[model samples]
Target chain A: MNEGTTVLITGATGFIGGRLVEMLAGRARVRALVSAYTRTSRIARYPVEMVRGDIRDEAAVAQAARGVDVIFHCAYGSRGTPEEKRAITVGGTKNVIAAARASGARLVHLSTQMVYGTPEKGVITEELPRQEGGGTYAESKVEAENLVEAAAAAGLPATILQPTAVYGPWAPVWTVGVLARMREGKVPLVNGGEGACNAVYIDDVIQAMLLAARREGALGERFLVSAREPVSWRDFYGSYEEMLGFPATVPVRVEEAVEPQRRGRRWALPQLLELAREEPSVRSRLGNTFEGQLARRLAGPLFRRRSTPSRTPELDKLRRLRSKPELPVYRLSPTDASFYASTARVEIGKAQRLLGYEPGYDLRAGMELTGEWARWARLVPAKAEEQQAQQKRKGVEAQ
Target chain B: MMVGAGRAAESLHLPAAAMTAQVTTSVIADRNLERAREVARNYGVEQAVAGAEEGKAFADAAILALPHHLHARVARELLEAGLHVLVEKPLALTAAECAELGTIASERRLVLEVGMVRRRFPALRFVKRALERELLGGIRRVTLEEGMPFAWEVTSDFTFRRETGGGVLADSGIHVLDLLAWWFGELEPVAYSDDDMGGVEAEVQFTLRLPSGAPVEVELSRTRELRNSIIIEGERGSLEAGLAFGGALRLDIGEAPLLIGQAQPHASEAGGDYQNVRELFIEQLENFRDSIRGTSSPLVDASEAMVAVGLLERLRAMREPLELPWVTANTTRAA
Candidate 1:
């Protein structure tokens, strides 16, 4: 974007939208349409004009969209019921589209590759037929894309970007969530993690977004944005495992993992303890009780039942000593297994050809960045200790 | 008079003032007169005013519960009007501003207590006494991790703005820093970093050296749930305490963890028994009132609260972009 360009970003508090605001803050007159419910700490550091309102509010959308050269419609509901998701994804896009059309501004819509649903074994492209029944998130995203396509067809200058498995710093799913699961040693691998992962770094998706907004040819088009090569799930998760200085994750069969979930016995004692440990409200309530105190005392020995030693000889003893006692194994559901087992590689050649978008970060580079953030964020204890040592050295030097 | 009918005022200050026998609910002032009226109606406050200037005339002392940036200016105005002031924490955005307000209050002989209600927590007070008595022996290192999802009902987006003194370090971390200063002696900055890429930081990690040369490692966040506890390792034993007002202190000296001071109903100085945070707020309000009357000194005066603000200022000045290798890698490649 040029210096004089004015842009309004919806979902400016979210991972992608927050990063966009960071990137575009000084380059353009950035205006963020934030919801009151979402914390504005992420975007409040910048000089962006923040307008608090939900995307469902049409008047708020129109007001925020006024005098903007472009509108980046990145806001979509990821939680709540199907109706709520549709209201935000489908309904919110309708409001954004109307605002963009009224203001004669280009619209850059962020869609997901999940819109393709569980595809058959083949390369997936933008021309592939959109599927439904994937889940609420995927279904709603498909509906949102349809609206964007309709708007583009109606002569509104708009482009839709379908990014595959966007992962990097601040990414809730592919980066942070994956690291959390791996750290917990609960990530289940379906078919030994052989499925194709069309993982793209967040920066690459953002680069595609910037290109889509600027290139005239990008209008009236849906671009599939991803890294140049698809990595195996083993490699994708293994990369994070390596970053955390941990051994490989043990793989389990899909059926073996899904059996307990199918029987509705997911909330076992061990899982409940894990949940109580993670949730503040649960911990506060349960921890105050005498039984909770007893359980807290016994939890170490109970969960730390000796298991088969790790296959990795060098790090097995260190891992055993340092890691929390092995909690119950977390298994992937049938849907997650299907998605992880898919071999369809997403094609981003159209984005490269049309918008001149090139994937800047490979999987290794992306994970490296994510690992750096995890360490800085204190998600990685090993790195934190190392950082502490470095800081102590710096202290000595200062003295 | 409560000068800001915002969340802290509505939830804590006004409710605590109603329970404070020495104080009366006089006036509620806010930029939004409707909000002031609503809060005043709920608390049985006598009047509602548009701003602090109008509300200052209604009461002998004023509780400045306004936004962070407005604290210095508004408190200065109230102090100049010969009103005792109990402003919220981080009395001003900078140590200089805090010192200026402290000077104003000192010259006028008005009570200028900062609303650092955590200092009034019985558990923390117990820890302070334990430290003073050398119960944990000589301190070696202290690690504090306090974080939860940002759920405080903020009336506006001021908490996220840098100019408005928003950020995890300045907002919540101030309390942690103050506790360190209160328990330990002076602090020397070692290293500081945060995840601020131009916006207010949701996460921050910093190290400070106590006068005893022991390190204090602090990790604060507004995005995720952390351990939310402070652990002090000393020569003889370690002390672990929860960050919350109701959080208990646990002595880890024995074979098993020993609970020391849990948040039981405790007797206030005013001959009443209350529980947890509400009790602490009441005690703080009482302290403010008594300080104004010269019966007792403020528990946390402006000069004492300035220690945290000064540390904050120094830390911010010394902050390095918490090294995100990936961001650097990408930027270098692009260059």
Candidate 2:
């Protein structure tokens, strides 16, 4: 496609989509298709031609898609009201693909790295299976991506760009909001976050999107676009500490973290018992019958004749533990904890090597820029609230 | 040079209402001509107001922005001259001196206002409103911590010398002491200790009883890092406002949203100490203007200002550098 080729983009008012419009505006005849709700004066100030319409509106999509050779479908929802996420990330994608097909335009569908389910190794490539039993947002993205893959297989000229945690100008998530909270001592790292999260600056993602558009080989394939390295949660937060000229309070450990959970469980037990007693069966003899029914059904299956014939003692012990209330079980592995516990880091080497990606901003520089904004806003202290509060707390604690 | 003045004039532009007719002007009366002229130029008053004969004609009101010892003499002169007076506080070095001004103001029926600009902060107003509404029900105790870093670090002529009423208690703690008196009424005498470090009183910790016998503690320090915070602990919640580095007031009421009082921005980032202190000075000026017009009494009047002066004099006498300190009772009751 030529630089002046008419390119219609859905989700153009969103974080990634907004940046994509700005990046692609000078290079092409950009027509942004934004939902009526997300439209603003900020979008109007930009050079791109903004068409007031939702992606779910077929007629609106068709009108936007008319005469456009390339459709950059860069919209998705992460943090929004539930109704918004449903209308945008799920129904929005369906509308975009339909529009693209109607105009016979090539589609570059922007997906997320989140669809790749929790992995044992923190290294997630395009080949990883989708996470099972993810809630509405994740499940919807998985279904949407599956549709895109099917469309590509059916010979539609389509490409998928799954970028990891994107940061820079116009980033909605993991932007200055999270940084501001962290600077104010509001966000504390909980659960030992061993999971690696990959970040790509907006400039790099734009470059990746352009490269995907020009290359014929990228069609009918998926690419992971992110910063070359994954930052661990400790080092991720240390960037803020470096900016503020303060030493990091030692990383909170898992056992210490679990202490709060244990306390919460103890506090909740009384409330749970009150709930149990208020039930109709609990106040009658039916409570005994309920316990008897539970034991008859559960005990016989565990004490099966074949249980003694189990080959592995570990499996036998596992079965015993399943029946026992006192035995403890660890449902999450360290690697899984890393993915769900702290922050997840992605490895974007494939995108870097294959897609020719290079990020413009580093984590330290980004954090310094973010800190400058925070200081100007007076969202956090300029110099000494922390130090003063520390001394006061120490004095009070000593007393 | 002219352009800089033009810009400064534009930057200093107050609303039309802020500029009232100069009904009562100051005979600023400083031997230091440069400082006096600077104050005059900033406030847009004439320079002859400082001279003795022309002083009374200009002195509808006298502003004693002089050292603590000089306040009583200046006040007595102005009061005798039949000019309403506003003085920078510790209204005088002694209770006797404070009472002299108080008696004169009472006799003349002229307003004698003391400049305590902390009360002008929006956060403090928010706190006072909350207290009135009983949001934090029946405020029982207050903890005040005040300091001026200059007292500890600098050996300057004004602050380091004790004869000028240069102790940390007089310079900074007086503000907190007066605020405590205003915040929790009917201050009953109680136990206190003074930690005198070197040339002046380095720190003083006082325990007082409210009229209702609620215990209030105040710790005044010149030794450590600078901070000014008053935590008003009420029956239901508490409010904390302080002179943060940026001169901010941070308010907290249990799990409720924290309302902060910050210096109104002049331009850009509202840079550094001069701007913050200058704004506070302007607030006091406005309040003084209001008091003269009978719109409202200036927040810190002579009576309240004298309480701080009285407390400081008693404190200076008691500063024996105690070895061990402890309070007998730490309890709060309904007011």
Screening candidate 1 with a backbone cut-off below 3 angstroms (N, C-alpha, C), the clashing residue pairs are: A45-B198, A45-B199, A45-B200
Kindly report the docking quality category of candidate 2. incorrect
Summarize candidate 1's per-residue lDDT along B1-335 as a digit string, tens digits. 89989889999888899888968978999999999999999988879999988888788899888778999999999999999999888798889999999999999999999988777666666678778989888787888999887888788877887777778887899999899899897889999999786768887999999887888999898876788888888777889877886677788774656767664433242233456577778888888888887899998888998999999999999898775465445432111
For model 2, residues B111-212, the per-residue Cα lDDT tens digits are: 888877656554545445556677777656667666542312221234433555655577677776776666665676576666433234545677777776
Quote the positional error of residue A264 for candidate 1 in Å: 16
- For each candidate, what is the lDDT? 0.81, 0.59
Instruction: List candidate 1 segments past 4 Å from native.
Output: A182-185, A243-334, A383-399, B136-138, B224-227, B250-274, B329-335
- Where is model 2 more than 4 Å wrong at Cα? A37-39, A78-84, A183-186, A190-195, A242-250, A255-345, A368-399, B1-335
Docking class of 1: acceptable
Best by lDDT: 1
Model 2: pairs clashing at backbone N, Cα or C within 3 Å: A195-A338, A196-A344, A196-A345, A197-A344, A197-A345, A197-A346, A198-A345, A198-A346
Candidate 2 accuracy as TM-score: 0.42
Interface RMSD of each: 4.2, 27.8
- For the record, the alpha-carbon RMSD of candidate 1 to the native fold, in angstroms, is 7.7
Question: Model 1: per-residue lDDT, tens digit, A1-399?
Answer: 777999999989899998888778777889999887347766776788999888999999999999999999999997798899889988999999999988988999999998888674699998888997888888988989988898899899999999999998889888878877776654656677888989999888888889898998898999999999999988998888777776435455554444333535664568755755554333333432334445657874653352233345465455345433343345566677778888889988899899988888899888877887776566765575787998897556434
